[model samples]
Target chain A: MFAAQAFASLFSSPAKTSSPSLASDHPTGGQAAHHAKPLFFTTPHHLKLTYFPIRGLAEDIRLILEESGIAYESENISFHDWHEGGIKQQRAADNPFGQMPILYVNKGEFILSQSKAIIRFIARSTGLDGGDAYSAARCDQLAEGIADLRRQYATLAYDKEFAAKVGDFINKTLVNSFTTIERVYDQNKTRYLLSQDRVSYADIMLFELVDQILALGQDARSVVAKFDRIGEVYKSIAARPRIAAYLASSRRVVAINGASASVGAFKA
Target chain B: MSGDGKYHVHYFAGRGLGEIARIALSEAGVEFEDHRFESLPADLKATTKFGQVPLLVTPAGDRINQSTAILRFIGATHGLSGKTALENAEIDQVIEGVNDIRAKYRALPADAANEERIKFFSTVLPQWLGYFEAILKKTGSGFYVGSNVTIADLYVYVSFDSVINKTADAQPIDAFPLVKAHLEAIAARPRIAAWIAKRPVSQW
Candidate 1:
């Protein structure tokens, strides 16, 4: 395990350093050598991370790079950036769905939609996938579970008519949903799921869900408090080294400085 | 971009339909394009098969629709789909089961009666959950369908998350213990955890 971590770090250092001039560098020998040397490498040379400047949905993949210790530059384009008629025209020419977080690779470019797919791909490549394929599958399952929970939240919370339907969805579907997770946590004797051995992508995703619930001021902690196992699971993930740093970093949150936002406003 | 290494995916924000494919592509460490539209342009609108988004355009100009179809293709290329024919079938079954449930849950009309939600919650939801429970139980491991992560597992989680989170009511978290536990196991991953933290809390 230590050896693998060491090797990953060794490769990551060069990979990040090599891509310093990536935006203007194009696919030259330096970048090609870096991409080619990896035992395994993801496609998409240039990934235009499209998202509302706010942390709407691109955070998962961003966190993947942080956790994997992969260094990459983030192009935080806001709604304003795309509002320009020319920008939209450019996007029409370049993009298929006309979305953001698109990765541009060496051979050409591969379009990836959906956060889970992007996050899972990053996890598998970074050695962050659970120890084995079975565990990895488990990790993917958990992420999907979180996505389900979030969808429910969106329907009631985001919709304009949230008052009418919020209660049932929250009380029945959302709240009732936690029981399924709690049971698994209780049955498993390990500190983490998949035998409580090592941290996996699933753990990170779960923690985020719980945290988001709390951040919404919804008292998600009190809801899950009954399940001791679930609590422990999230605690373990929150304590991860890289994750802790990210949460502590100023750049960790959305970059809301006026310079960027003003530029974004004008661009839009 | 190099022709041999190019791939592309299309979808909107908010983790709708396209999330599963994104996870699969990332897990495989394969690079691809993530083409996005900002509020559905007219020209791109004409290109969409159904005028809905999430169309994957390959370098060879192969444009594909349906989020699952894109996932299966990427899974095939990355060796994440399955090792055998039988395994792939099982994976497909799991995906189908998940999709069936999602359709039922999402189709809940705006004017749906409490009984409708109740029926889904008690009868259909449990039955679907039980099916997954049985499959995972047989493996003596946490994953479903096959010995590895396939499009099935990804689809299930997304479906489960969507149903649980998108609903307009609240219920006890203990009702679906196995499903919840499965979710926790996946959430505990480092990369995934990071992904979650970085995502907007309200959106998740």
Candidate 2:
């Protein structure tokens, strides 16, 4: 009954009716409609990210922001507001898909709504994407591979029967997936995923994937430990001055996943 | 290296994840083998980077896994990629939007009697369609990303084509005028139309 009421309140919020259309001239008013004003892809915008308090998809972008040393702002949408009050309390419904982790350029001058898209945007702007055409393609290859691994990990994290399935996931799924990933990691034979001198966005992605899996407790940790290259790459990324500082800072997200996860739902 | 100078796309027979990569090749006027596997054998699975299909084998015998990765590689090699960094991001946002909805659809049990599944078709699917429709209107170029047909347009077209074909909706895009026009415009393209006609029929 309470859940229903809260949901009702969320839909009935005053901001719900006001579409984030482009004509508003409100400068910061995010025009969310596909029927929005004409937006040309010519310039860059100031960066701000809005997402739930969880680190589900936003972590990689956050890692990029930290490593890039670019000044940015982050807004967290609490579960309470999303259910009882509507997310518009933080900002208007500017997201295309109404999903979080939306990157607002110049406070809604433009809103990029996908995590992978946002990651590539920031990574490119910050020079963390890659150096040349060939290296850039390799970065994409690594990121996509990490994404597949993340999918398997996400299923385990969100499974209602998490306890029942986690062991099998660790033994079979984790092992098999890593076998292929590690092989790719071994291909470059370098200190970083991309080059000996530069760490690309794919390295950050790999680091976070390893970190999240490590949070699944000792057995899961043991499974991931076998991937020496992934571990080596993870350590190198963590040791970066900005990244190291960020890890110990208050801005770092403590929660590894959502509260529904069977494990590592640590809250800041 | 095979030294055959032909790309080989390995995936299940249907146009699922592999369709975008296949579409990229088709759009670029590249001839490649559409290697289908009804059941992926363990030996082949072991060789892939993520133990997943929709892997692309370049003419050089480099095995690339993940559907999007293969698509990106093809987009880069060919002219299917965005004209600029910002344009590239625009293309990716559209592709990811399609992927996001597909993930939601995949989570649903395929029972017409299922309440959630019914809600998905009735509510969730329309909401997503409106989102895409809005994007089409905003771009105003009759394309998703920029002024040209890119991998973004290909991804959007195949995703909706598969979905509506499954539902057998006579007028799936009726409520979405721009999306409707975009679908027709994409379908009428010579290569895409030819591929659609020649492709194998399967129960998606």
Candidate 3:
């Protein structure tokens, strides 16, 4: 079975983010808000990232753009607005998949969707992807491994009975997930996941995933802390100047459920 | 084929994920040891890095999983991915698009009611078919990304033949003329045609 294909539908829907209501409060109350023109067409030679305001699927992409020092326009679409008339009336006109994290490249002429696809595209162009075919494949494998772990975590995190079964989730699923990652670290024995001298996109992806898991709860954090290599990676990546600034800035959406929910889960 | 080390592909005896990589290898004229398992052997399963099949043991003795990653390796090694970053992105987009449709069908429950199945055929299937049709029209190259055949074309072709065409009571592809023609054109490639004729027939 193609697990990637089996789980692709899980990510097909637009990712939702937690944010203060923007329905009435238009922060940028100028021609920009009024016009509501397709951002892709007007923007040129700059990365245009469209996603929910919350740091869900787009968080890693945002970190990449910032770390690359690339000039990008980050549009945080309000969930309320999207449901009302935003996506159908305006956003859907340009996006083929009608999903968030759609990237506009090459002066807005080329539209790329699918978070992983977009991530790889940016990584390759920016040299965050490995130097050669083998290294690149290694990076891709690690990214896919992180994705698989996330998929397994989502099963428990998104469950309606999550609160009651949090212990089971951490013990049975979460620990195993971290162990799998730890094994990869052990095998590679490098500062980075793939043994690349510098940070690759996979390292960034792994850092984000570990950070999210730690954010779940004290139990989650304590368990994840046991993985020394993962802890090292998280610390190193978080200390990067741009990433550090982004984490400290208001741009980083506040944790929704304080360690109980997954990275993208909205507070109940 | 150029390397002295062995290239072994381990997957079940079926035309699933393994087929696309196999097609790419065949198209590139690379020699690899085809290791098909009637059912996954316990030892092999345990040894797999990701506990998954469609694992490509590179000549360098590194084990790789995930079909897309394997395809990328094959494409990069064999020069079928693309010439530039933009072209590779386009190719990735197409492969992901094809995966989206495949996922939708795979998501259907095993005990799905007749109405749900019918709904899939009538609505969902046509929607994706139309999207692929539009893609071919927009590209205007008869291939997915560029002027030449890439791994995306091979993937789209195998997916349509193995998954969409194999569905029970599947609709004909007559509506999407370009997609239909694209499938035929890929199948008629000399090496691909030879593989299709000689490769072991298995029920996916």
lDDT of 2 by residue, A1-268 (tens): 0012222221222122343222133232221211111222223346788877877899999998889777678888776676568665444346566666788766565567789999987776566766343455567777887787798889889899998998898889888777777888787788787777588999899899888888878998888888898888888889999999999988887887877787777454
Candidate 2 per-residue lDDT, tens place, B9-107, comes to 888988888887888788777789998878997877767666678888877676777777677666655656655555667788888889888888788
For residues A1-268, write the lDDT of model 1, one tens digit per residue: 0012222322333213333222224433121221212323433234345445544456666666677666555655556666764565565423322445443332223333335545655565555665333345445455555666765664445555655665566467656667666655555578776656566676666776666555433544457676677788777766778877887886465432222322111222
Worst 10 residues of 1 chain B by lDDT: B82-91
True contacts kept of 1: 0.00
* Candidate 2 clash pair list: A20-A31, A20-A32, A34-B134, A34-B135, A35-B134
Instruction: After superposing candidate 1 on the true structure, give the runs of residues whose Cα lies further than 4 Å from its correct spot.
Output: A1-48, A83-89, A92-95, A106-111, A163-169, A195-197, A254-268, B1-204
Model 2, residue B181: what's the lDDT?
88
- The candidate with the higher lDDT, 2 or 3, is 2
lDDT tens readout by residue for model 1, B107-185: 6765546778778776777666665666676554577644555566667776677677665653433575666787776
TM-score of chain B of 2: 0.94
Better of 1 and 2 by lDDT: 2
lDDT tens digits, residue span A1-268, model 3: 0012222222211111132111113332111111111211222366688877666677778888777767787776667677685574575535555566678654465667777878887787666775466677878887888887765565567677777777887787778767777777877879886554578898999888887777668898889879898888889999989889888988777642223454455542
Model 3 lDDT per residue over B35-91, tens place: 898888898777766667888887657688888888887776665665455566678
Clashes, model 2: 5
Provide the overall lDDT of each model, using Cα atoms, as 2-decimal numbers: 0.55, 0.74, 0.72
Best by TM-score: 2
